[model samples]
Target: MNTSRLEAFSDGVFAVAITLLVLQFVVPDVQSGKLLAALLGQWPQLVTYTASFLTVGVIWVNHHTIFKGLRAVDRTIQFINLILLMFVVLVPYPTQLLGRYLNSGFNASVAAAFYGVS
Candidate 1:
C-alpha cells in the first residue's frame, strides 16, 4: 500500500473523530440562565475532551513521524498499521464515557486507568 494513501486515510479519520467529539456535549433543555451554569458544571467533560484531543493529536503526529521513516510496508506491516488505526477509532467511546459519568466518580478513575494503559 502506498504510504501517501495510508496517511491520507488516517488524516481523514482523525479529522472526522475530532469533529465528532463535540457531539458528546449535549445541551440541556433548561432556561438560558441555567444553561451557562450547566455547561460550566460539566467541567470534567471539557477536560476529558481536551485531554483526549491532545492525546489523539500526539498519536497522529507520532504515526506520521514513524511512517515517514518507513521505506515500504509489507502485508503484515499494513495489517499492523490498520490495527493501530482501529484503536484510534475507538477513542471517542471512552472519552464520551468518562465525560458522561465524570461526576459519579467511578468513570474518572477508570478513565485514568485506561489513560495510563493507553
Candidate 2:
C-alpha cells in the first residue's frame, strides 16, 4: 500500500473535522441591548471549540511525526493508522454533543464524559 494515499486521506479527514467544529457555533439571538450577554453565555461552545481545535492540531502534528519515521506502509501499520484516524474523525461528534448539552445537568456530564473519552 502507498503511504501517500493514506496520508492524503487522513489529512482530508482532519481538515473536515476541524471545519465541522465551527459549524456547531450558531449565532445567538437576543435583544439588541443584550447582545453582549448572549455572546458571553456561549462560553461553553467557545471553550469546547478551542479544546477540540487544539486536540486535532496536536494529533496532526503527532501523525506527521510518526509517519516521518516509518520506512514504508504495511498492512499492520495501515490498520493502526486507520484506528487512530477513526477516532480523529469522531472528535467533532462528541464536541458538538458537549456544546449542545453543556448546560443540561446530567446530560452535560454525559456529554462531557463522551467528549473526554473520544
Candidate 3:
C-alpha cells in the first residue's frame, strides 16, 4: 500500500523501457566510402529514439512528482498505475514502427498515427 514499492517498481519499468529504446539502433553496415551515407540514412531512427527517450524521461519525472504528494497508494491508484506502466512498456514498439516507416511514403503517415495513438 506504500508508495515506496510502487515507485521502485515503476522506476524499474521505466529504466527497462528506456534501455530497450536503444536496441532499435543497429550499427550501419557499409564500406568505408559509404559509411557516412549509411549512417545518415538512419535519421528517422535517431529522431524517434530521441523523442521516445525524452518522453519517457518526462513521464518518469512527472510520476515521481505525483507519487511524492501521495502518502500511500490505494487499489484504484495501483490499477491505474499498472495501466500507465503498460503503455510505457509498449512505447518501444511504436517507436520502432515509426522509425522504420517514417520515410516509407504512405506507410510513414500510418506509422506516425500509430505512434501517436500509442
Candidate 4:
C-alpha cells in the first residue's frame, strides 16, 4: 500500500497548505496613506488570513482524526487522500478573493458564499 509514501504525501500537502495560509499576511504597500486608512484597507487581508488559517488548522486536525482510525491503506485510499488534498490546496484562492474584495457589499456576499463552499 506504500504506507510511507501516503503519509509523506499527506504531510507535505498539509505543510504547504499551512504555509500558504501564513503567507497571506504579507505586509501590504500603503505608501503615503493615512495610517487609519491603510489599516482599514488591509482589514480584509487580516480577516481572510484569520479565516483561512483556522480553516487549514481545522482540516489538518480532521486529517489527523481520520488517519488515526486506519491501520493501513491501499491504492484507492491513496488516490482518495490525494483528491482531498487537491481541495485543501485550492483553499488559498478563495481566501485571497475574500481578502481582496471583502470591503465591498457585493464582495461580502461573495465572501459568505466562498466560506460556505470552503
Q: Which candidate number maximizes TM-score?
A: 3
Q: For candidate 2, which ten residues in a row score worst on lDDT?
A: 63-72
Q: lDDT score, residue 40, model 2?
A: 88
Candidate closer to the true structure by TM-score (higher is better), 2 or 4: 2
Worst 10-residue lDDT window for candidate 1 reads 109-118
* Candidate 1 CA-lDDT value: 0.80
lDDT score of residue 79 within candidate 1 = 82
1 against 3, candidate with superior lDDT: 3
Task: Score candidate 3 by lDDT.
Answer: 0.96
**Candidates' C-alpha lDDT:** 0.80, 0.89, 0.96, 0.80
Task: Give the Cα-based TM-score of candidate 2 against the true structure.
Answer: 0.89
Best by lDDT: 3
Task: For candidate 4, give the lDDT.
Answer: 0.80
In candidate 1, position 109 carries an lDDT of 86
Prediction 3 TM-score vs. true:
0.96
Which residue runs does candidate 1 get wrong by more than 4 Å?
114-118
| Rank ordering of all candidates by TM-score, starting from the highest | 3, 2, 1, 4
Clashes of each: 0, 0, 0, 0
Under the 3 Å rule for N, CA and C atoms, how many clashes does model 2 have? 0
Candidate 4: how many backbone clashes? 0
